[model samples]
Target: MADPILVFDLDDTLYLERNFALSGYQVVGAWMQARYGVTDFAQRCTKRFETGAYTGIFNHVLRDLGLMDSPDLITRLVELYRNHPPNITLEPDALRFLSLPRYKGKRGLITDGPPRTQANKIAALGIKDQLDFVVRTGEWGAGFSKPHPRAFGYLEQAFQAHPEQMVYVADNAAKDFVTPNARGWGTVQIVRPLGIYKTPPADRAHAPAATITSLDDLTRCLTQF
Candidate 1:
């Protein structure tokens, strides 16, 4: 077999997405302090997270608070979260997976989000040195976002791999696996406990070739092909 070309999703697969969310919350808290002189925002965030209310933190804590209902304030909050230097660390399983001998494949990353936001994540995880190619869908515009197949096609070309030789490992089932499945490329979804997306809901119409809980399981999963 030749070296497989694998493209991974950034946010929840390479590292815990919640960690980035936490860091962004801190940034939002600081912005709130500076602009509105409000305190305890972080504490409130902690409470929300503890209760498993992870998504929409900004919408509830900031926008609903009436202190930041303006569009400019929302943009500034987004800028702050996206630009803030994060304390993210690569998932041990992810690091180990990258080093494993069985995955002797061309590795790349394809993420869909604001370019700077995703780039900050790449730097924070310290995996820029690990990836052979990267294509952020938002950089090209929303038309190329995941499930659109353009970014996946871009990765296949960048790695010089045919669709059959290309594999995509990602977390989100709603869109992550759609394009790869439709394009006849292999698709894997790694869902860890810390991932933002819980159960893939088994919708076979979008099922992965293998649904793993650890990146380390990838070697075994790839063999089935």
Candidate 2:
């Protein structure tokens, strides 16, 4: 088979999503401290997140600090978290994998997040020059996120390749593989040691064709299909 057009997911697949969350927490915390004199907001927020509080973390943190979790306040904090310049880096294996000679000019990225946030991450990772193209689902609209197939379709048109000639490497099995699998695209899940989604797919429909612990093993995984 021809060398497949390699597309990747941005968050946990290329870098630990935890790092982004931590970085954003720091940003939000710093803002809170400066504005409301809450010096421990960042630490408190981080603690809540580490304890698996994935939703309404800000609300919990505010309640802890005896502050009202008002809609305006939550919105402001969220905007601050998503718009800040994130301090993050690519995973070591991903860094090495992207630099490999065989994949040059064959790489692309499809990521979902607030457009500003995703752009900030892509810039911080310094991967813009390394990829042939990047598709940020936010640019299209919230409804176009993974499992929606809009971003994947964009890649197909951009590469002018058959679905079978493309592969999507991502972390979240819950929503990452369904559309790609149905479209005949090869899908591989990269289960990073610190990745957020670790549970087995509920059914085969959501499962990746192959699973690897790191991008370092991506080449070998691709050979199977």
Candidate 3:
């Protein structure tokens, strides 16, 4: 039987996913400047993305910059941004957390997003080999996205582990905890200052079993298992 599972969330949970976004912006910015001679295009694009105004962001950026006449700009930028390979490093806390001698072999991961995009990140972070089971919910279809339970259910089945025997660590309170918490799994949120989601979610079901400011806090709790 598989040892008890320790699942993780990718993106901002394990590494600063903003780093990935920033990398894309750098590429997009340079591509724009070279092709259109736009000054400060990259910085403006980065600011827009960081503000969470992503819908039609490329078109909006162009329009704001008086490049409104550009044809197919949004589609081209979207494709470029999504395809750009990200240069990222695991946070030192993540390295320290994973370096724990006890938790090494039990690790697994569950993440949501475009399969190829997310796959690039996992490969970039070099965490694939460390995982015993992996599930990218987008590969499973829209119905399986987090808080849907099916993705969590998939992990349980993959490892032949039950909810009580699994521990899930993710940073997003908006969607990460609902299914695991409802199923009786151990859920912990790493609310690091660097994490993207900082405010407490309004829904009570989204609350985790425990909350920690860092990954190192998990060592003491996991030893209980």
The candidate that wins on lDDT is 2
Evaluate residue 54 in candidate 3 and report its C-alpha lDDT on the 0 to 100 scale.
Answer: 53
Ranked candidates (lDDT, high to low): 2, 1, 3
Q: Report clashes for each candidate as comma-separated counts.
A: 0, 0, 0
Task: Tell how far residue 144 is off in model 1, in angstroms.
Answer: 1.5
Candidate 3 structure lDDT? 0.80
- Per-residue lDDT tens digits for candidate 1, residues 13-58, read 9998888877877878877888788786766776687678866666
TM-score of model 3 (CA atoms): 0.90
Looking at candidate 2, what is the lDDT of residue 179? 92
Weakest lDDT window of 10 consecutive positions for candidate 1: 61-70
Where does candidate 1 clash, by residue pair?
none
